[model samples]
Target: MKLFKSIIYICLITISLCSVAMIYGETRQSQWIDKFIDSFELTNSNFKFYNIKANMMIEKDIDMNELQNICLLIAQNLTNNKDEVCLKTEKSQVYVNYNDKNTGISIVGIKKNAKESYIIVDILNNKVYKNIENIYTKLENELSEYSNDVDINVCIAGEYTKKLKKAKISDILQKILYNMYAEKISDIEEENFLSVNAYSKLLKENNLKYLDREINLNIGIRYSEDDDKTMIYIATPIIKIDY
Candidate 1:
């Protein structure tokens, strides 16, 4: 009977450890969002949120076929039997796009690499802030089942109907950085675009280095003629989507 009790205790401890590993990168979502929203509010641009997106990369030495199948399963679980389109296929890559129009959930998956397969999952939605948090939390939980070592990037974007000048955009970026008490590591300004890379001790998420400086905040702004609006993207670590 003592041996049986010991075995049960071991199982319980194992399960608890697994649970902690699964939620590796989830504790800072609310903080990140609040910072993003509050910083943007400083601009006083009165922009409307375009979307909240998450890009997650899972790296493990798995076969391309296995990665593709896993991506398919993840999409199905995300969209609940929605139709998915195979966007592209190459010798070493497969891209799938899943859109559940009714739910406003768009998921794109890609399995690519010549030597070792890596999976990229992009999930986007224009829902309430709480809903966005819930969606990505579920996604992280699901992806953790496959690989504990996953890298995630979450971003929120907003747009103003009027186009702003390059100087104006730069001022906006500076305002946001100052509001967040972030250290500006690097910045670029083009005729129609402006971006700044920064680091802040207030953020409790992952960090990457650029030119020997730690960076966790990324702010970008550009004018889009297609939408007749000026777009702004704020992300932690970096922005993955094209401006």
Candidate 2:
């Protein structure tokens, strides 16, 4: 009876740990959205980060003040210090920032309704050392208590979007497109497929008029194993911001 009781306790402890991990992985969705920020190294081992934003939603009856305090706890864990601030307002989310050397992690949690609230984590660092998905997963585990006995939805990601808007390759491609638009090519030429680097080489720096440089580039292309297959080009919409 003693041996059986010990085995049962061990099993219970193991099950508890597994349940916690499963909660963080299954309840948090936004971290998986982090693939948009390319973590590839420029050289053999050096890595840098660009602007990236990811969204996660929490379904619970939460208090603003309590959540803000929880965010402070998370910020402390992330930064290894007590430097944290909560920007609270009636309508806006309980925003918090963990001040760091580079642009730090900015978390904004907004209440969608009494039962649902959304949180967005925007990484503005010039270079990020760790993978963002991992970082947010850690954060989710820490904040899992807030989601106790509630409906939590986590989005899983298998791949990044092909449309280059806000992608790592977007800036360079936009430069090339600006040059073509500068020449005022009314007779838009269509190539079934072309390499991004090769297409940029076709246009010279002088060809760019600087007009429409701020326009968004929507590049959704997939490489096909079949040589005869062609990439499809879709019309891109230009979004204007009032601010």
Q: What is the C-alpha RMSD of each candidate to the true structure, in Å?
A: 4.9, 15.0
Q: What is the lDDT of residue 84 in candidate 2?
A: 50
Most TM-score-accurate candidate: 1
Instruction: Compose the digit string of candidate 1's lDDT tens values, residues 30-139.
Output: 55656666886677654444343445555656666776677677666776554654445566666667655434444444554533445567766554444555666677
What is the lDDT, from 0 to 100, of the residue 69 in candidate 2? 66
**Ten consecutive residues with minimal summed lDDT in candidate 1?**
101-110
Give the per-residue lDDT digits (tens) of candidate 2, residues 88-135.
555646777765676566767787787787666554554553455566
What lDDT would each prediction earn against the true structure?
Answer: 0.68, 0.43
Predicted structure 1, TM vs. truth: 0.68
